[model samples]
Target: MTDQVATTEAPEDWEPSEVQRERNEWRRRRTLRSAVIAAGSTLLLLGIIGGLVVSSPGWERVQATYFDWDKAVSSFPAVLEGLWLNIRVMALCAVLIVALSLTIAVMRTIRGPVAFPLRLVGTAYVDIFRGLPLLLVIFLLGFGGPALSLQGLPTSALFWGCSALVLSYSAYVAEVFRAGIESVHPSQRLAGRSLGLTYGQTLRHVVLPQAWRRVIPPLMNDLVSLQKDSGLIAVLGVVDAIRAAQIQTAIDFNYTPYVVAGFLFCCLTIPMARLTDRYARKKGYHGAGGHL
Candidate 1:
Protein backbone atom coordinates (compact mmCIF):
# COMPACT_ATOMS: atom_id res chain seq x y z
CA MET A 1 0.00 0.00 0.00
CA THR A 2 2.80 2.43 0.93
CA ASP A 3 4.77 1.58 -2.28
CA GLN A 4 1.70 2.06 -4.50
CA VAL A 5 1.97 5.04 -6.83
CA ALA A 6 -0.70 7.06 -8.53
CA THR A 7 -1.04 6.27 -12.27
CA THR A 8 -2.24 8.62 -15.04
CA GLU A 9 -3.33 7.85 -18.53
CA ALA A 10 -1.25 9.30 -21.40
CA PRO A 11 -2.88 11.81 -23.72
CA GLU A 12 -3.62 10.55 -27.22
CA ASP A 13 -1.67 11.97 -30.21
CA TRP A 14 -3.33 14.98 -31.74
CA GLU A 15 -4.37 14.14 -35.32
CA PRO A 16 -7.18 14.76 -37.80
CA SER A 17 -10.03 12.29 -37.57
CA GLU A 18 -10.29 9.46 -40.12
CA VAL A 19 -13.30 11.06 -41.85
CA GLN A 20 -11.52 14.42 -42.13
CA ARG A 21 -8.42 12.71 -43.58
CA GLU A 22 -10.55 10.81 -46.12
CA ARG A 23 -12.33 14.07 -47.09
CA ASN A 24 -9.05 15.83 -47.68
CA GLU A 25 -7.74 12.94 -49.76
CA TRP A 26 -10.94 12.98 -51.82
CA ARG A 27 -10.67 16.72 -52.42
CA ARG A 28 -7.03 16.40 -53.52
CA ARG A 29 -7.86 13.60 -55.92
CA ARG A 30 -10.80 15.54 -57.32
CA THR A 31 -8.62 18.60 -57.93
CA LEU A 32 -5.87 16.58 -59.60
CA ARG A 33 -8.41 14.79 -61.82
CA SER A 34 -9.98 18.10 -62.85
CA ALA A 35 -6.63 19.60 -63.73
CA VAL A 36 -5.62 16.58 -65.76
CA ILE A 37 -8.90 16.58 -67.67
CA ALA A 38 -8.72 20.30 -68.39
CA ALA A 39 -5.13 20.10 -69.66
CA GLY A 40 -5.74 16.94 -71.69
CA SER A 41 -8.92 18.28 -73.28
CA THR A 42 -7.26 21.56 -74.24
CA LEU A 43 -4.32 19.70 -75.79
CA LEU A 44 -6.68 17.39 -77.68
CA LEU A 45 -8.73 20.26 -79.08
CA LEU A 46 -5.67 22.18 -80.18
CA GLY A 47 -4.18 19.07 -81.81
CA ILE A 48 -7.39 18.32 -83.67
CA ILE A 49 -7.66 21.87 -85.01
CA GLY A 50 -4.01 21.88 -85.99
CA GLY A 51 -4.36 18.52 -87.76
CA LEU A 52 -7.36 19.71 -89.73
CA VAL A 53 -5.57 22.89 -90.85
CA VAL A 54 -2.46 20.96 -91.79
CA SER A 55 -4.56 18.47 -93.73
CA SER A 56 -6.25 21.27 -95.73
CA PRO A 57 -5.25 22.19 -99.31
CA GLY A 58 -3.91 25.69 -98.38
CA TRP A 59 -1.54 24.39 -95.72
CA GLU A 60 1.39 24.20 -98.14
CA ARG A 61 1.03 27.80 -99.27
CA VAL A 62 0.41 29.00 -95.72
CA GLN A 63 3.52 27.19 -94.53
CA ALA A 64 5.56 28.57 -97.41
CA THR A 65 4.40 32.11 -96.61
CA TYR A 66 4.17 32.22 -92.82
CA PHE A 67 6.05 29.32 -91.30
CA ASP A 68 9.28 28.99 -93.27
CA TRP A 69 11.84 28.54 -90.52
CA ASP A 70 14.71 29.30 -92.91
CA LYS A 71 13.26 32.70 -93.83
CA ALA A 72 12.47 33.45 -90.16
CA VAL A 73 16.09 32.81 -89.19
CA SER A 74 17.40 34.92 -92.08
CA SER A 75 15.11 37.86 -91.19
CA PHE A 76 15.93 37.92 -87.44
CA PRO A 77 18.88 40.32 -87.53
CA ALA A 78 17.15 43.06 -89.54
CA VAL A 79 13.97 42.75 -87.50
CA LEU A 80 15.98 43.00 -84.26
CA GLU A 81 17.66 46.22 -85.42
CA GLY A 82 14.27 47.80 -86.11
CA LEU A 83 13.02 46.46 -82.77
CA TRP A 84 15.66 48.57 -81.02
CA LEU A 85 14.03 51.71 -82.45
CA ASN A 86 10.64 50.46 -81.27
CA ILE A 87 12.02 49.85 -77.76
CA ARG A 88 13.49 53.35 -77.56
CA VAL A 89 10.25 54.92 -78.74
CA MET A 90 8.28 52.77 -76.30
CA ALA A 91 10.48 53.85 -73.40
CA LEU A 92 10.06 57.53 -74.24
CA CYS A 93 6.28 57.20 -74.71
CA ALA A 94 5.93 55.25 -71.45
CA VAL A 95 7.59 58.08 -69.49
CA LEU A 96 5.47 60.78 -71.13
CA ILE A 97 2.24 58.80 -70.78
CA VAL A 98 2.77 58.21 -67.03
CA ALA A 99 3.63 61.85 -66.32
CA LEU A 100 0.75 63.40 -68.31
CA SER A 101 -1.77 60.84 -67.05
CA LEU A 102 -0.88 61.46 -63.42
CA THR A 103 -1.31 65.19 -63.87
CA ILE A 104 -4.71 64.72 -65.52
CA ALA A 105 -5.80 62.31 -62.80
CA VAL A 106 -4.96 64.82 -60.07
CA MET A 107 -6.74 67.61 -61.90
CA ARG A 108 -9.86 65.49 -62.34
CA THR A 109 -9.98 64.69 -58.64
CA ILE A 110 -9.86 68.36 -57.58
CA ARG A 111 -13.18 69.63 -56.13
CA GLY A 112 -12.55 73.39 -55.86
CA PRO A 113 -14.49 75.87 -58.03
CA VAL A 114 -11.17 77.21 -59.27
CA ALA A 115 -10.33 73.70 -60.50
CA PHE A 116 -13.48 73.41 -62.62
CA PRO A 117 -11.77 74.27 -65.90
CA LEU A 118 -8.97 71.81 -65.31
CA ARG A 119 -11.45 69.08 -64.43
CA LEU A 120 -13.46 69.83 -67.55
CA VAL A 121 -10.34 69.60 -69.72
CA GLY A 122 -9.27 66.38 -68.08
CA THR A 123 -12.70 64.81 -68.61
CA ALA A 124 -12.77 65.91 -72.24
CA TYR A 125 -9.33 64.46 -72.85
CA VAL A 126 -10.34 61.10 -71.43
CA ASP A 127 -13.57 60.98 -73.39
CA ILE A 128 -12.05 62.02 -76.70
CA PHE A 129 -8.89 59.92 -76.65
CA ARG A 130 -10.51 56.85 -75.12
CA GLY A 131 -13.20 56.88 -77.78
CA LEU A 132 -10.97 57.72 -80.77
CA PRO A 133 -9.46 54.75 -82.57
CA LEU A 134 -5.73 54.43 -81.91
CA LEU A 135 -4.91 53.91 -85.58
CA LEU A 136 -6.79 57.07 -86.51
CA VAL A 137 -4.91 59.04 -83.90
CA ILE A 138 -1.62 57.68 -85.19
CA PHE A 139 -2.51 58.43 -88.79
CA LEU A 140 -3.49 62.02 -87.98
CA LEU A 141 -0.41 62.78 -85.92
CA GLY A 142 1.94 60.80 -88.16
CA PHE A 143 0.80 62.35 -91.45
CA GLY A 144 -0.67 65.61 -90.21
CA GLY A 145 2.30 66.66 -88.13
CA PRO A 146 4.68 66.66 -91.05
CA ALA A 147 2.12 68.16 -93.42
CA LEU A 148 2.11 71.37 -91.31
CA SER A 149 5.81 71.76 -92.22
CA LEU A 150 6.26 74.71 -89.86
CA GLN A 151 9.78 75.89 -89.19
CA GLY A 152 11.39 73.99 -86.29
CA LEU A 153 8.48 71.52 -86.21
CA PRO A 154 9.59 67.89 -86.01
CA THR A 155 9.18 66.26 -89.41
CA SER A 156 10.19 62.80 -88.25
CA ALA A 157 7.65 59.96 -88.48
CA LEU A 158 9.04 58.48 -85.23
CA PHE A 159 8.46 61.74 -83.38
CA TRP A 160 4.86 62.23 -84.44
CA GLY A 161 4.06 58.52 -84.08
CA CYS A 162 5.40 58.54 -80.54
CA SER A 163 3.46 61.70 -79.79
CA ALA A 164 0.27 60.00 -80.95
CA LEU A 165 0.97 57.05 -78.64
CA VAL A 166 1.60 59.36 -75.69
CA LEU A 167 -1.63 61.31 -76.24
CA SER A 168 -3.83 58.23 -76.65
CA TYR A 169 -2.30 56.11 -73.87
CA SER A 170 -2.28 59.02 -71.41
CA ALA A 171 -6.08 59.19 -71.48
CA TYR A 172 -6.45 55.47 -70.69
CA VAL A 173 -3.82 55.65 -67.99
CA ALA A 174 -5.43 58.72 -66.44
CA GLU A 175 -8.67 56.80 -65.94
CA VAL A 176 -6.78 53.92 -64.32
CA PHE A 177 -5.07 56.36 -61.97
CA ARG A 178 -8.36 58.05 -61.14
CA ALA A 179 -9.99 54.72 -60.32
CA GLY A 180 -7.04 53.72 -58.13
CA ILE A 181 -7.17 57.07 -56.32
CA GLU A 182 -10.88 56.72 -55.60
CA SER A 183 -10.40 53.18 -54.30
CA VAL A 184 -8.18 54.54 -51.51
CA HIS A 185 -10.05 54.11 -48.24
CA PRO A 186 -11.73 57.32 -47.07
CA SER A 187 -10.14 56.78 -43.66
CA GLN A 188 -6.69 57.18 -45.20
CA ARG A 189 -7.67 60.57 -46.62
CA LEU A 190 -9.11 61.67 -43.28
CA ALA A 191 -5.99 60.49 -41.48
CA GLY A 192 -3.80 62.49 -43.83
CA ARG A 193 -5.96 65.59 -43.35
CA SER A 194 -5.86 65.14 -39.60
CA LEU A 195 -2.10 65.03 -39.73
CA GLY A 196 -1.99 68.67 -40.92
CA LEU A 197 -1.53 67.68 -44.54
CA THR A 198 -3.16 69.78 -47.26
CA TYR A 199 -5.18 67.96 -49.89
CA GLY A 200 -2.38 68.01 -52.44
CA GLN A 201 0.17 66.99 -49.86
CA THR A 202 -2.09 64.22 -48.67
CA LEU A 203 -2.64 62.94 -52.18
CA ARG A 204 1.04 63.15 -53.06
CA HIS A 205 2.39 61.69 -49.83
CA VAL A 206 -0.27 59.10 -49.01
CA VAL A 207 -3.00 58.48 -51.54
CA LEU A 208 -1.00 58.26 -54.78
CA PRO A 209 1.66 55.92 -53.44
CA GLN A 210 -0.96 53.41 -52.35
CA ALA A 211 -3.11 54.00 -55.40
CA TRP A 212 -0.22 53.32 -57.78
CA ARG A 213 0.63 50.11 -55.99
CA ARG A 214 -2.94 48.88 -56.27
CA VAL A 215 -3.07 49.76 -59.96
CA ILE A 216 0.34 48.45 -60.95
CA PRO A 217 -1.08 45.36 -62.65
CA PRO A 218 -3.42 47.34 -64.90
CA LEU A 219 -0.72 49.91 -65.66
CA MET A 220 1.72 47.21 -66.66
CA ASN A 221 -0.96 45.65 -68.84
CA ASP A 222 -1.47 48.97 -70.64
CA LEU A 223 2.27 49.39 -71.06
CA VAL A 224 2.49 45.94 -72.64
CA SER A 225 -0.30 46.81 -75.05
CA LEU A 226 1.52 50.04 -75.86
CA GLN A 227 4.74 48.13 -76.32
CA LYS A 228 3.16 45.90 -78.94
CA ASP A 229 1.27 48.78 -80.55
CA SER A 230 4.60 50.42 -81.24
CA GLY A 231 4.49 48.28 -84.34
CA LEU A 232 1.60 50.42 -85.61
CA ILE A 233 4.12 53.18 -86.21
CA ALA A 234 5.23 50.99 -89.10
CA VAL A 235 2.17 52.19 -91.05
CA LEU A 236 3.69 55.68 -90.92
CA GLY A 237 6.94 54.40 -92.47
CA VAL A 238 8.66 54.60 -89.09
CA VAL A 239 10.86 51.54 -89.93
CA ASP A 240 10.03 49.72 -86.70
CA ALA A 241 10.23 45.92 -86.40
CA ILE A 242 6.97 45.40 -88.25
CA ARG A 243 8.07 47.68 -91.08
CA ALA A 244 11.35 45.85 -91.30
CA ALA A 245 9.46 42.56 -91.39
CA GLN A 246 7.13 43.85 -94.12
CA ILE A 247 10.06 45.09 -96.17
CA GLN A 248 11.79 41.74 -95.77
CA THR A 249 8.65 39.87 -96.73
CA ALA A 250 8.27 41.99 -99.84
CA ILE A 251 11.83 41.19 -100.84
CA ASP A 252 11.74 37.45 -100.11
CA PHE A 253 8.12 36.79 -101.14
CA ASN A 254 7.55 35.21 -97.74
CA TYR A 255 5.55 36.21 -94.67
CA THR A 256 8.01 34.52 -92.28
CA PRO A 257 9.54 37.85 -91.32
CA TYR A 258 6.24 38.89 -89.84
CA VAL A 259 6.22 35.66 -87.83
CA VAL A 260 9.67 36.47 -86.48
CA ALA A 261 8.57 39.94 -85.46
CA GLY A 262 5.49 38.47 -83.79
CA PHE A 263 7.60 35.93 -81.96
CA LEU A 264 9.88 38.66 -80.66
CA PHE A 265 6.89 40.63 -79.38
CA CYS A 266 5.55 37.50 -77.70
CA CYS A 267 8.89 37.00 -75.98
CA LEU A 268 8.73 40.54 -74.58
CA THR A 269 5.05 40.33 -73.60
CA ILE A 270 4.83 36.87 -72.03
CA PRO A 271 7.06 37.75 -69.05
CA MET A 272 5.10 40.96 -68.47
CA ALA A 273 1.80 39.08 -68.71
CA ARG A 274 3.01 36.52 -66.15
CA LEU A 275 4.17 39.27 -63.80
CA THR A 276 0.82 41.06 -64.10
CA ASP A 277 -1.00 37.86 -63.17
CA ARG A 278 1.28 37.31 -60.18
CA TYR A 279 0.76 40.88 -58.94
CA ALA A 280 -3.02 40.58 -59.37
CA ARG A 281 -3.11 37.36 -57.34
CA LYS A 282 -0.88 38.79 -54.61
CA LYS A 283 -2.99 41.95 -54.40
CA GLY A 284 -6.14 39.85 -54.21
CA TYR A 285 -5.11 38.38 -50.86
CA HIS A 286 -2.66 40.91 -49.35
CA GLY A 287 -4.17 44.20 -50.57
CA ALA A 288 -3.59 47.78 -49.26
CA GLY A 289 -4.03 46.80 -45.63
CA GLY A 290 -0.85 44.75 -45.89
CA HIS A 291 1.05 48.01 -46.20
CA LEU A 292 -0.53 49.50 -43.09
Candidate 2:
Protein backbone atom coordinates (compact mmCIF):
# COMPACT_ATOMS: atom_id res chain seq x y z
CA MET A 1 0.00 0.00 0.00
CA THR A 2 0.97 3.66 -0.51
CA ASP A 3 0.92 4.21 3.28
CA GLN A 4 3.42 1.37 3.85
CA VAL A 5 5.74 2.76 1.17
CA ALA A 6 5.57 6.26 2.67
CA THR A 7 6.37 4.96 6.18
CA THR A 8 9.30 2.89 4.87
CA GLU A 9 10.68 5.90 2.94
CA ALA A 10 10.60 8.11 6.02
CA PRO A 11 13.86 8.98 7.80
CA GLU A 12 15.29 6.21 10.04
CA ASP A 13 14.80 6.37 13.87
CA TRP A 14 18.44 7.42 14.30
CA GLU A 15 17.87 10.28 11.83
CA PRO A 16 14.75 11.52 13.73
CA SER A 17 16.85 12.84 16.63
CA GLU A 18 18.88 14.96 14.20
CA VAL A 19 15.64 16.17 12.58
CA GLN A 20 14.23 17.19 15.98
CA ARG A 21 17.37 19.18 16.83
CA GLU A 22 17.14 21.00 13.52
CA ARG A 23 13.43 21.72 14.09
CA ASN A 24 14.14 23.19 17.54
CA GLU A 25 16.90 25.41 16.17
CA TRP A 26 14.55 26.62 13.46
CA ARG A 27 11.92 27.48 16.08
CA ARG A 28 14.41 29.56 18.07
CA ARG A 29 15.37 31.50 14.97
CA ARG A 30 11.69 32.08 14.14
CA THR A 31 10.99 33.40 17.64
CA LEU A 32 13.92 35.80 17.45
CA ARG A 33 12.75 37.04 14.07
CA SER A 34 9.24 37.60 15.40
CA ALA A 35 10.52 39.60 18.36
CA VAL A 36 12.65 41.83 16.16
CA ILE A 37 9.71 42.44 13.82
CA ALA A 38 7.47 43.37 16.74
CA ALA A 39 10.00 45.79 18.13
CA GLY A 40 10.44 47.51 14.76
CA SER A 41 6.70 47.85 14.23
CA THR A 42 6.19 49.33 17.68
CA LEU A 43 8.93 51.88 17.13
CA LEU A 44 7.48 52.85 13.77
CA LEU A 45 4.01 53.30 15.22
CA LEU A 46 5.33 55.47 18.05
CA GLY A 47 7.24 57.66 15.58
CA ILE A 48 4.09 58.29 13.57
CA ILE A 49 2.12 59.14 16.68
CA GLY A 50 4.83 61.49 17.90
CA GLY A 51 5.04 63.24 14.56
CA LEU A 52 1.29 63.85 14.50
CA VAL A 53 1.22 65.24 18.01
CA VAL A 54 4.25 67.46 17.51
CA SER A 55 2.66 68.99 14.43
CA SER A 56 -0.65 69.81 16.12
CA PRO A 57 -1.66 73.53 16.45
CA GLY A 58 -2.33 73.15 20.19
CA TRP A 59 1.09 71.68 20.92
CA GLU A 60 2.73 75.11 21.15
CA ARG A 61 0.19 76.35 23.68
CA VAL A 62 0.51 73.17 25.74
CA GLN A 63 4.28 73.43 25.73
CA ALA A 64 4.18 77.06 26.79
CA THR A 65 1.70 76.41 29.63
CA TYR A 66 3.00 73.11 31.02
CA PHE A 67 6.64 72.89 29.98
CA ASP A 68 7.98 76.43 30.11
CA TRP A 69 11.58 76.13 31.18
CA ASP A 70 11.72 79.56 32.82
CA LYS A 71 8.57 78.96 34.89
CA ALA A 72 9.82 75.52 35.95
CA VAL A 73 13.13 77.03 37.09
CA SER A 74 11.41 79.74 39.10
CA SER A 75 8.94 77.35 40.73
CA PHE A 76 11.50 74.81 41.92
CA PRO A 77 12.68 76.63 45.06
CA ALA A 78 9.25 77.13 46.67
CA VAL A 79 7.96 73.71 45.64
CA LEU A 80 11.08 72.02 47.07
CA GLU A 81 10.75 73.99 50.28
CA GLY A 82 7.06 73.21 50.61
CA LEU A 83 7.68 69.49 49.96
CA TRP A 84 9.76 69.36 53.16
CA LEU A 85 6.64 69.83 55.29
CA ASN A 86 5.11 66.78 53.61
CA ILE A 87 8.26 64.77 54.33
CA ARG A 88 8.20 65.72 58.01
CA VAL A 89 4.50 64.93 58.44
CA MET A 90 4.75 61.65 56.57
CA ALA A 91 7.75 60.53 58.65
CA LEU A 92 6.01 61.26 61.92
CA CYS A 93 2.82 59.57 60.74
CA ALA A 94 4.74 56.51 59.55
CA VAL A 95 6.14 55.84 63.01
CA LEU A 96 2.89 56.57 64.83
CA ILE A 97 0.76 54.57 62.39
CA VAL A 98 3.00 51.51 62.63
CA ALA A 99 3.06 51.51 66.43
CA LEU A 100 -0.66 52.16 66.78
CA SER A 101 -1.65 49.66 64.10
CA LEU A 102 0.38 46.89 65.71
CA THR A 103 -1.28 47.58 69.04
CA ILE A 104 -4.71 47.47 67.40
CA ALA A 105 -3.90 44.21 65.62
CA VAL A 106 -2.70 42.60 68.85
CA MET A 107 -5.80 43.69 70.71
CA ARG A 108 -8.02 42.25 67.99
CA THR A 109 -6.21 38.91 68.04
CA ILE A 110 -6.39 38.38 71.83
CA ARG A 111 -8.90 35.63 72.70
CA GLY A 112 -10.62 36.16 76.03
CA PRO A 113 -13.87 37.47 77.50
CA VAL A 114 -11.91 40.14 79.35
CA ALA A 115 -10.48 41.33 76.05
CA PHE A 116 -13.82 41.26 74.20
CA PRO A 117 -14.68 44.94 74.55
CA LEU A 118 -11.15 45.99 73.57
CA ARG A 119 -11.35 43.73 70.53
CA LEU A 120 -14.68 45.23 69.58
CA VAL A 121 -13.25 48.72 69.85
CA GLY A 122 -10.31 47.73 67.66
CA THR A 123 -12.67 46.21 65.05
CA ALA A 124 -14.84 49.33 65.01
CA TYR A 125 -11.83 51.59 64.65
CA VAL A 126 -10.56 49.68 61.60
CA ASP A 127 -13.97 49.49 59.95
CA ILE A 128 -14.87 53.16 60.39
CA PHE A 129 -11.61 54.59 59.05
CA ARG A 130 -11.19 52.09 56.23
CA GLY A 131 -14.76 52.53 55.02
CA LEU A 132 -14.69 56.35 55.02
CA PRO A 133 -13.26 58.32 52.13
CA LEU A 134 -9.76 59.60 52.88
CA LEU A 135 -10.58 63.12 51.75
CA LEU A 136 -13.59 63.27 54.06
CA VAL A 137 -11.47 62.24 57.04
CA ILE A 138 -8.87 64.83 56.13
CA PHE A 139 -11.54 67.53 55.84
CA LEU A 140 -13.15 66.70 59.17
CA LEU A 141 -9.92 66.42 61.08
CA GLY A 142 -8.33 69.48 59.50
CA PHE A 143 -11.35 71.82 59.69
CA GLY A 144 -13.18 70.30 62.63
CA GLY A 145 -10.17 70.15 64.95
CA PRO A 146 -9.35 73.83 64.67
CA ALA A 147 -13.02 74.76 65.26
CA LEU A 148 -13.03 72.85 68.59
CA SER A 149 -10.69 75.57 70.01
CA LEU A 150 -9.82 73.50 73.09
CA GLN A 151 -7.13 75.24 75.09
CA GLY A 152 -3.80 73.35 74.84
CA LEU A 153 -5.06 71.18 71.99
CA PRO A 154 -2.87 71.85 68.96
CA THR A 155 -4.72 74.22 66.64
CA SER A 156 -2.13 74.00 63.86
CA ALA A 157 -3.51 72.80 60.49
CA LEU A 158 -0.43 70.57 60.19
CA PHE A 159 -1.29 68.83 63.46
CA TRP A 160 -4.86 68.03 62.46
CA GLY A 161 -3.91 66.82 58.96
CA CYS A 162 -1.23 64.58 60.41
CA SER A 163 -3.77 63.20 62.86
CA ALA A 164 -6.17 62.33 60.06
CA LEU A 165 -3.42 60.65 58.05
CA VAL A 166 -2.34 58.66 61.08
CA LEU A 167 -5.89 57.63 62.00
CA SER A 168 -6.91 56.35 58.55
CA TYR A 169 -3.66 54.59 57.74
CA SER A 170 -3.50 52.86 61.12
CA ALA A 171 -6.80 51.16 60.38
CA TYR A 172 -5.67 49.80 57.01
CA VAL A 173 -2.32 48.69 58.34
CA ALA A 174 -3.85 46.97 61.39
CA GLU A 175 -5.61 44.63 59.00
CA VAL A 176 -2.32 43.87 57.33
CA PHE A 177 -0.68 43.02 60.63
CA ARG A 178 -3.62 40.91 61.77
CA ALA A 179 -3.56 38.95 58.52
CA GLY A 180 0.16 38.29 58.94
CA ILE A 181 -0.35 37.16 62.53
CA GLU A 182 -3.21 34.84 61.71
CA SER A 183 -1.28 33.24 58.86
CA VAL A 184 1.06 31.71 61.43
CA HIS A 185 -0.33 28.30 62.40
CA PRO A 186 -2.06 27.94 65.78
CA SER A 187 0.46 25.19 66.62
CA GLN A 188 3.22 27.79 66.81
CA ARG A 189 1.34 29.67 69.53
CA LEU A 190 0.62 26.39 71.34
CA ALA A 191 4.27 25.35 71.08
CA GLY A 192 5.32 28.64 72.67
CA ARG A 193 2.86 28.12 75.49
CA SER A 194 4.05 24.55 76.02
CA LEU A 195 7.60 25.86 76.28
CA GLY A 196 6.52 27.96 79.30
CA LEU A 197 6.30 31.20 77.37
CA THR A 198 3.56 33.59 78.41
CA TYR A 199 1.21 34.91 75.68
CA GLY A 200 2.92 38.31 75.76
CA GLN A 201 6.38 36.74 75.64
CA THR A 202 5.37 34.47 72.75
CA LEU A 203 3.99 37.39 70.74
CA ARG A 204 7.03 39.48 71.45
CA HIS A 205 9.64 36.85 70.56
CA VAL A 206 8.07 34.31 68.23
CA VAL A 207 4.82 35.41 66.63
CA LEU A 208 5.62 39.04 65.80
CA PRO A 209 9.03 38.34 64.29
CA GLN A 210 7.59 35.92 61.76
CA ALA A 211 4.45 37.97 61.19
CA TRP A 212 6.49 41.09 60.46
CA ARG A 213 8.55 39.23 57.90
CA ARG A 214 5.42 37.95 56.19
CA VAL A 215 3.79 41.38 56.06
CA ILE A 216 6.74 43.59 55.08
CA PRO A 217 5.69 43.77 51.43
CA PRO A 218 2.15 44.87 52.25
CA LEU A 219 3.45 47.27 54.87
CA MET A 220 5.84 48.81 52.38
CA ASN A 221 2.99 49.24 49.91
CA ASP A 222 0.92 50.98 52.59
CA LEU A 223 3.81 53.24 53.54
CA VAL A 224 4.26 54.24 49.93
CA SER A 225 0.60 55.25 49.73
CA LEU A 226 0.88 57.11 53.03
CA GLN A 227 3.90 59.07 51.82
CA LYS A 228 2.01 60.20 48.71
CA ASP A 229 -1.05 61.24 50.70
CA SER A 230 1.14 63.68 52.59
CA GLY A 231 0.25 66.10 49.82
CA LEU A 232 -3.39 66.01 50.90
CA ILE A 233 -2.43 68.16 53.87
CA ALA A 234 -2.50 71.04 51.41
CA VAL A 235 -6.31 70.96 51.70
CA LEU A 236 -5.96 72.18 55.28
CA GLY A 237 -4.21 75.32 53.87
CA VAL A 238 -0.81 73.99 54.85
CA VAL A 239 1.69 75.23 52.27
CA ASP A 240 2.79 71.84 50.95
CA ALA A 241 4.02 71.26 47.38
CA ILE A 242 0.58 71.26 45.81
CA ARG A 243 -0.29 74.49 47.61
CA ALA A 244 2.96 76.06 46.44
CA ALA A 245 2.12 75.01 42.90
CA GLN A 246 -1.30 76.63 43.14
CA ILE A 247 0.24 79.92 44.29
CA GLN A 248 2.78 79.88 41.49
CA THR A 249 0.15 79.07 38.90
CA ALA A 250 -1.97 81.99 40.12
CA ILE A 251 0.96 84.40 40.03
CA ASP A 252 2.24 83.47 36.59
CA PHE A 253 -1.07 82.57 34.93
CA ASN A 254 0.61 79.38 33.67
CA TYR A 255 0.19 75.73 34.63
CA THR A 256 3.92 74.96 34.39
CA PRO A 257 4.40 75.18 38.16
CA TYR A 258 1.89 72.39 38.74
CA VAL A 259 3.88 70.21 36.35
CA VAL A 260 7.06 70.95 38.26
CA ALA A 261 5.47 69.98 41.56
CA GLY A 262 4.01 66.85 40.03
CA PHE A 263 7.42 65.99 38.65
CA LEU A 264 9.01 66.30 42.09
CA PHE A 265 6.33 64.12 43.67
CA CYS A 266 6.84 61.53 40.93
CA CYS A 267 10.58 61.63 41.59
CA LEU A 268 9.98 60.69 45.22
CA THR A 269 7.16 58.24 44.48
CA ILE A 270 9.11 56.31 41.86
CA PRO A 271 11.99 55.62 44.25
CA MET A 272 9.64 54.39 47.00
CA ALA A 273 7.84 52.12 44.52
CA ARG A 274 11.13 50.66 43.34
CA LEU A 275 12.29 50.03 46.89
CA THR A 276 9.00 48.29 47.70
CA ASP A 277 9.36 46.06 44.63
CA ARG A 278 12.97 45.28 45.52
CA TYR A 279 12.11 44.34 49.09
CA ALA A 280 9.14 42.27 48.00
CA ARG A 281 11.33 40.30 45.59
CA LYS A 282 13.99 39.89 48.25
CA LYS A 283 11.38 38.58 50.72
CA GLY A 284 9.79 36.19 48.15
CA TYR A 285 6.58 38.33 48.00
CA HIS A 286 3.51 37.25 49.99
CA GLY A 287 1.23 36.84 46.99
CA ALA A 288 3.50 34.29 45.33
CA GLY A 289 3.40 31.39 47.81
CA GLY A 290 5.32 33.26 50.47
CA HIS A 291 3.12 32.92 53.58
CA LEU A 292 0.78 35.88 54.12
Positional deviation of residue 199's Cα in model 1 after best superposition, in angstroms: 2.2
Least well predicted 10-residue stretch by lDDT in candidate 1? 2-11
- The window of 10 residues in a row where model 2 has the poorest summed lDDT is 283-292
Q: For residues 1-292, could you state the per-residue lDDT of candidate 2 as single tens digits?
A: 9999987895665455788999999999999999999999999999999999889999999999999999999999999999888788888999999999999999999998999999999999999999998889999989999999989899999999999999999999999999999999899999999999999999998899999999988898888788789999898889999999999999969999899988888888878878888788777664532322
Stretches of candidate 2 off by over 4 Å are 1-49, 286-292
Best by TM-score: 1
- lDDT score for residue 175 of model 2: 98
**TM-score of every model?**
0.84, 0.83
lDDT for model 1, please: 0.90
lDDT of 1 at 98: 97
**In candidate 2, how many Å is residue 109 off?**
0.6
